[model samples]
Target: MSRVSRRRFLEDSLIAAAIAATWAPSRAESEGSLGRKVGPNERINIAVLGVHGRGLDHVKSFAKMKDVAVVAIVDPDSNCFEKAVKAVEELGKPTPKTVQDLRRILDDKDIDAVSIATPNHWHALAAIWAMQAGKDVYVEKPVSHNVLEGRRMVEAARKYKRICQTGTQIRSAVGSREAIKFIHEGGIGTVYLARGLCYKRRDSIGKLPDGPVPQGVDYDIWLGPAPKRPFNPNRFHYNWHWNWDYGNGDIGNQGIHQMDVARWALKKNKLPNSVISLGGRFGYEDDGQTPNTQLAFMDYGDAQLIFEVRGLPTPDLLGVKIGNIIYGSEGYVAFTSYSTAVVFDSKGQKVKEFDGGGDHYRNFIDAMRSRKESDLTADIEEGHLSSALCHIANISYRLGSPQPFNPRTKAFGDDKEAYETIGRFEKHLAENGINLNEATYRLGPKLVLDPEKESFVGSAEANALLTREYRKPFVVPDKV
Candidate 1:
């Protein structure tokens, strides 16, 4: 990975970035066909992994596509399989096989692709193994558990020549594509900044004692790659998003969507030159270790991106919450929802609007038949890079401490907007009756990062976090 140059990384990844922002499909990408042609009437056999929350969506969505079949459902919890099988049946699709482990599904030569909605820890590994088993893949957003895993996921897709898609469905939304097109066409003038706002409230998880594993659940398989531990409700199901071992916190949970949009608007391929975060899990005490409130600023040289996450109950900022606020010199665009974009002028008057409709699943199916990775919205690289930002932000927060920073010099110097943002964040918390001792609050060091090498400069602690040690058999191989 160190041998990979910045230019090469940017050049290789720019296609996805451009496609995401401008909806401009290259000639080669538009015309290329999947190595093996699947006639219009041919069927694409897919298996949905991790059949719980997001996984159920995969089962139903695939079941509706013409000539696409949900051949199997995989999950460590038998209860999840039951629910997914019911979902498939309710959709009028033939009942698919249900399995408690992914290995059996991977062995079936008939499977064409795997729709993976597994836990964050399982995402990269499952996708890689599926591709290794001679199948294409449609992985959910933040495609890796760690930065290193993301890079490896991209390598596996390319090395195996498999068609892979990321589940950042906004890329398929007509409104989002049109909005980005507008931004790039001078509608928004010179875009220099983007603010991703996630202001939803999360109540305390309240500590729970480690409990016995539920019957019919392959707990060992569920814990694959993650550290060995007793099963607790807080660490399972939707709650996993708040646990660092299984999730990337709210920023990685719902925040990745906005982060992807911010990067797309800037056409950023390589990562930011520097990053810093200040915040913590305030409001209440619980089993959740990840911060409930966070402010992360990424300096991308010419421009900057700011992401704010507030889990305590709060009102929207400038009528925007859990959405993206892209600021340009002349105007701005607010992605209000999955399918709606509202553009505003410098005077705060709404200028243009766009509505959305498109199926990311259908996009993948079309690309699978064409055999061109570009035809699909959110290719694997797109997912990896966007997901990497989440991991990067987490590292900064994990190693944070109150420190001075300068937005002008792009390093630690006199304080500026970064300080202002944190100041406002603190004020908001206080307004909501949450107060910190101030001293315990951490502000990350203004660590310099080399985009080309994808590592921190002169910081062994930060560099070591780029990857992680994997357990045997479940390990994410360095070479993919």
Candidate 2:
């Protein structure tokens, strides 16, 4: 296995550290100068990347914003442009130039910013390239495919002094904001635990035969940052979430949002002291490589964060699925959705409710206009911390086995609880008609971590999974 070298890391950071000072894009580079240097009232030109799915929303959102123009729309698939352009025109905005190549779009100086909704693998590299090209960025959730990439992304944003927003919209949602604020104000009386649920319904993709690359799809560019392999439907588009090559499964896909909120509730800004995970892909066998049902546990010393992703049907945790529940000494809060939250007494009776909503895209624009990274609703730093948790959990599972952890030290040295957690997880899969005798669950070790360094203590194999071998040209530079 290829290990990331310190030399590469130093090389990338040195170059990127000076990019902001020397490479920041100027108003003169804009393709359309708006007849004057861009001022407070001038429209900011932006490019929307990956229109095949979430990028479509990005195209339309920017189109409706005041003093914003969707100048370019990018996608590897040419077919996505039709709908993206139609969405822009229907909103009364001028048609944006549709280009299939992202690097080509990065070359245009007219573009002030780019909103990226590409698959998990392309997120970090795209944002880095955009910032290196002097453009602000708005990237989607689990901002990187792995831990190292996420940290690199944060570096690129800070070093370049570029405004990069992670698409964890709840950070900007009024309801979630108010609820978390309440917890911070002693409404929840010293929050002690947070549970993130991602019980999104998922069915098996089932196995499919290898196939020819689809027409108009630049398969090479689409596989950017990930290793090249035989083309298969299961590893493309949304289904890519199930593969380690391109995605971090549901936890990194949907659970990162809730996990962010969980960490935010605890008021922690760094990695946990230790992390471990247990579970397996249940239901049916398929091309999917990621576990459909999994549980992650993180210890923060004073508190704990737990997250569960149930791809199969299951009852809601604390009356909510796909959200967060923060427990405190006095009461608990249920962040049910992006725009809704509920507070309950220790008796479990509803005591208060909150409902508010805001636009994350608009928040990014506000920060960009003000040239203040602090104004961002979901800053890149916040995105990196949360996404790293998903990576840590995955690393444990990928190289773990059932083992005991020290109760007093809370380090991996004993195994009763680990066995119990795995047993329950096995029961869960069995209820879904999955026989564990044929395929037992993988239980990860309790990997102690230096929250500051973000590495597994004394475990080289675990650390190696923190970064992947990048393909040429599309590589996520170690320095950046």
Candidate 3:
């Protein structure tokens, strides 16, 4: 057997043993709602990283849990430290711990678990390090910035016998599980295609000439594993969700959630055999590197799935509904972001509809105490697979030629048919209010990819982006 496979097998064996040894009865497993349990609060000492944005939600949720205590909060931004300190102080509990460095938090042997809400680039590294430090991990979605990092995280978790959960909170929703179960059980008979959509409006990320570091922000540390670039406020805070260096556009940010649900209902654990993606920034002119509007199709032999993202304000998109639809042989299942799901037959008659609402953090804490990874409705592997699908689409779009559609044929004709392809891309952009005439588009041409190898087939430029150059002293080693 290969070294990696051998290592994986041994790690799996160790994890199995750990699970068996640490088994504890969970009230939720029997009594439904997770409530006060037996013993002296047996609270798990926890530290949270990236306590800004969604990080605050993690803290608030964990604080309400009977068996979990927020022991520390870490963030590179001093502003976040101040906010987190106030939050912990308001909890009516003693000031637990506070730090600006994650390394210090990880080094503290007293911490039993960690919740990571850092940017996409930091997800995998933080999780892997936490696992190595013998702490269970709860990492936010789009679990890795790239494919290899996610695989590495899974390996590290297994090797260290850590209970790791991905923050695709929707999976734990009672309604979500029921919807998926119904679809799998033939409510959506012979499911052929699962479609996901995100149609949220976003403004420009400013046109400020990039320069100067912001006060109280460690811009250098923030760019640890990513290539250094001029600091721009447009590329910080929520705006980071749009940049290629720090984010995966809406696909990884929001679309991944619905994509996750689709994959779960479909029970797929690997990438599709073939993929085709098209679209670009169609509305507002922004500093974002990824497409503002895009469509991706994945061919999975017997079935296919499509992922669509519209960052622009597109009217009547997805039949005037913004959510996911699973088209099956007999019926379809539709889910809204509000956690509402309904099944409709070929006749367009509604058959079943339900609401999925619940607390995600409570579920993770329950699973942690039970020592059963399966108890996690959305496991790390599941999140990785869904996120990988999004990554594949983005990668394909980056490699594919800018093709314009021919109105007569209603199909795209690319550079091979240069005139027709360019026409289609141009027309599509114009229809969506993008002005190609205003400026040049930095478009990438089509290239072959070998997903198994995690590299481009013949393109050096494309392959170079697969992994980033890390800064000195903050680098994530090639091998742990």
Q: How does candidate 2 fare on TM-score?
A: 0.88
The worst-scoring run of ten residues by lDDT in candidate 1 lies at: 24-33
Better of 1 and 3 by lDDT: 1
**lDDT (CA) for every model shown?**
0.82, 0.83, 0.72
Error of 1 at 195 (Å): 0.7
Q: Which stretches of candidate 3 lie over 4 Å from their true place?
A: 1-41, 316-321, 407-465
lDDT of 2 by residue, 1-480 (tens): 125655754554465344423543344432222222357988899999998888888988999986999988888777788999999999888889976668766768688899999999999989988887778899999999999999998988877778899999999988888888899899989788888889898999989998998866767778877888888988888999999998898999989999999999999999999998877777778999898888888889888888888899777767889899998999899988877999999999999999999999999999888888889989999999999999999998788664322122233345444444445555566677775556666677878898889888998998899898888767788775
Best-matching candidate per TM-score: 1
Error of 2 at 398 (Å): 1.0
- Model 2 ranges off by over 4 Å: 1-37, 402-427, 435-439
Clashing residue pairs found in predicted model 1: 33-370, 34-370, 34-371, 201-311, 401-443, 402-443
Which order, best to worst by TM-score? Answer: 1, 2, 3
- Between candidates 2 and 3, the one scoring higher on TM-score is 2
Better of 1 and 2 by TM-score: 1
Model 3 lDDT tens row, 1-480? 789967965774465345434433233322222222323457688888888799998887787665677889887676787777677668765576766557666556567889999999888877876776667889999998877677777776665656789998888788877888888888868988887777666666756678787655667657767787898887888788888888998889988888888777777777676565667776666678887777776667677677767665555333524678888999888887647788888988988887969887887787778767888877788877888878877777777665434332223243133333345446555776665556344333444556566556676866665666766555555654
Residue-level error in angstroms, candidate 2, position 374 = 1.2
**Per-candidate TM vs. native?**
0.89, 0.88, 0.83
Model 1, 35-125: lDDT tens per residue? 2345678899999999879998899899987789998998888877777888878878889997766766665767889999999999998
